[model samples]
Target: MKRLNILVTGGAGYLGSMISTKLIEIGHNVTVIDILEFNKTSLSHLFVKKGFKFIKADVRNKKLLKNLVKKKDIIIPLAALVGAPLCDKHPKKTKEINFDTIRYILSIIKPSQKMIYPNTNSGYGIGKKNNFCDEKSPLNPISLYGKTKVDAEKIILKHKNSVVFRLATVFGYSFRMRTDLLVNFLVNKAVVDGEIKLFEPHFRRNYIHVLDVANAFIFAIKNFSRMKGNIYNVGLSTANLTKLELAKLIKKYVSGTKIRIIKNRKDPDKRDYFVSNKKIEKLGFRPSVSIEDGIKELNYIYSNFNFKKNKNNY
Candidate 1:
């Protein structure tokens, strides 16, 4: 295997921190560029590794991005306004960071440099009952965050020697934890808040662990020749469940948790769909962590750390 210089734009983030650390452990030189909008301590563990580097900067800086893009063998663009509510609140910043920065990178990236993009399954919006959305499924994004990512996905698809992974809702513990995610959010509330109320309990969605998502990027890098220029849905086939089912699972871990369903309430996110992982799994990439296991892990983390005063860590 060839050792490469990889640049991760949001290396301090929930997903990026894990990917960067794993790449360094496997002997690749990983450089992370992040603005530290959340917790800055997430990637600090990577400092001991000689192959790791961190730069505190925004991805929207074109001059800085051009200079960095020229030096990297692979670029993983992970920085973005991640959730729908946050993106809606800051639409202007979302457009610049998510869409415009991608265009800048595409124009300046070298032909030999590989680009691995992280897209959301939210792009699928809603799926038909009992059906799975594959990479070929038509995207009908209903939120600002999903729309921006869909536009960015078009850029990656048009580029040669590039790959995109439309990941399902990610769970499990991370150095930079995000309670905003579906599984993590609900589980945290059940444990800390002592109960959780559901608006659309029957809404379905697929899930994958954080480390599994990191492994998908690594798998794509190792098999770039076979997977480049294609999009794959990265999700756990067995873990697709409705929101109500998810709450019940959490109730098992958090004792005395009450789950109440609110009738006729709509999910603001509006993304409720089951995703297929057959395409990526056929390429020898399989998710390792189960939702049950992730729940246990989060239960332990929350037990060890108090999230009440540190809500900004997300």
Candidate 2:
């Protein structure tokens, strides 16, 4: 094993914060550059750590990124307007941040520098009937968010020594909380509002814990040689569930959680598919968090923290 200098582009967001902390804890020198759109509290703990550095900047700032990308061994691009609704609200920013920023990095980064990119499972929009989607599955993304991620993955995959993880809906508690994600949103509603509303009850998708997502990146960083130039579906096989089914799970933890289904109501993110994570599993990485466990963690967060809950964060 070797110590490396790591750069995380969106190091203050949910998954970025988790992964950046993990890298620093494992003896890697980590530099995180974020615009702090949400705030800087998620990274407040890291500021005191020995091997961590934080920079407030945009990834699209070519003047800064040109010098920054050249200084690190690995680049983890986690800065993006994640989720369908947020991407919908800011389509131009989504394209620039999620897709074009990768294009810009590809141009400036040396071929020797390794990359790990988080592509979304939403790219498998309306997958093949009754079958689980794999790395070979055709990406027919319907939302601007999903489309941009798919495009970015293509560029990163073509880069030498780069890895891609087509991640599922990430859940679990984070310092920077997000209510727009399906599981997190439903659990928040169930706990605080006591009712969960579903527009499409039968719409199925995969989920992974925020920690597990960070673990996947750690696994790739440790095994970059074997994992490079390949795409893996990073999610729990047991956690492929629907909206109503997810509501019922939340009900178990938060009692008296009511569920309502609305007819003909369309989801902004329109993603419905199960993913097969066999490729990454074969490479010695498996997701350890289940949706049920994630629900328990959320229940604990809602019980302990005074979260300013809002339903329209996206």
Candidate 3:
């Protein structure tokens, strides 16, 4: 494969940190732009690489973004306010970064340049019972976070030169680890607190490892001709599980963890759906890490490491 010039926004973030490093390792010239909201040292190790370049700036800066867009062969937009709770806290900021920044990029980039975007499968809010959601499924986003991502996806599809991955709830460890994610949170609670409280435990959802998601970007870059103009649901097909089932799995790793199921209580974030990964799988993309492996990794991290000063939650 020939070396290509690629730009990644939010490169110091959890998923971005992994993606930036992988792109550099494969001999691509990568330029990363991030404001470093969480941890400043996430990309500290990549500073010495010849192909890696880091710029500390917000994606909403139109002048800086337009200049960067002109020189890249491929663009991966990973910058956004990720979860529902975080988006709720900053509604105005969410609209500007998640939706508006994307619109601005679409207007400036040439039709020849390729863009790979990551969207959440939570857009399939409250799916019909016993039914699986595919890429063709109707998107009914519940939260501000989901709505902005779904809206952004609609505009990206119209461009016909972009690839969108409707990703499942991502898990596992990265250079910038996130413990607030469902699987990671449960595992950490089990290890540290030895107990958990569940509301609406039977609501089902899908999952995928963070590394698998990073690899999907590389796969799309290599096969852009075949993947562009289409949206694929990226996830592990074996891991469609409910909150209760997930807690039980964590207990297997962390022995004697107590689980308290709270009935008649409501979960504020009511995203519940099972996703079908058949589309991406047919295209020859498979996720390597299993939920069991991810839980074990999180268990080790929480039990041994000192995250006293680390901001693991957003």
130-182: candidate 3 lDDT, tens digit per residue: 55799988778888998999999999998889999999999988888788888
Assess candidate 1 and give its TM-score to the true structure: 0.96
Candidate 1 lDDT over 1-314, as tens digits, reads 78899999988999998898889989999988899888869988889999888889999888888888898999999999888888888999999999999998999987888999999878674645545688988777888888999999998888898999999999988888888788888888888888989988888899999999999999999999999989999988988899999999999988888998989888876767777789988989888999999998988888778866554422
Better of 2 and 3 by lDDT: 3
The alpha-carbon RMSD values of the candidates against the true structure, listed in the order shown, are 1.6, 1.6, 1.3
Ranking by TM-score: 3, 1, 2
List where candidate 1 sits over 4 angstroms from the true fold: 125-131, 311-314
Backbone clash pairs in model 1 (N, Cα, C under 3 Å; residues 3+ apart or in different chains), count: 0
Q: Any runs in candidate 2 off by more than 4 Å, and if so which?
A: 125-127, 309-313
lDDT score, candidate 3, position 102:
96
Where does candidate 2 have its weakest 10-residue lDDT segment? 305-314
Better of 1 and 2 by lDDT: 1
Q: For model 3, how big is the CA root-mean-square deviation?
A: 1.3
**What TM value does model 2 have?**
0.95
TM-score per candidate: 0.96, 0.95, 0.97
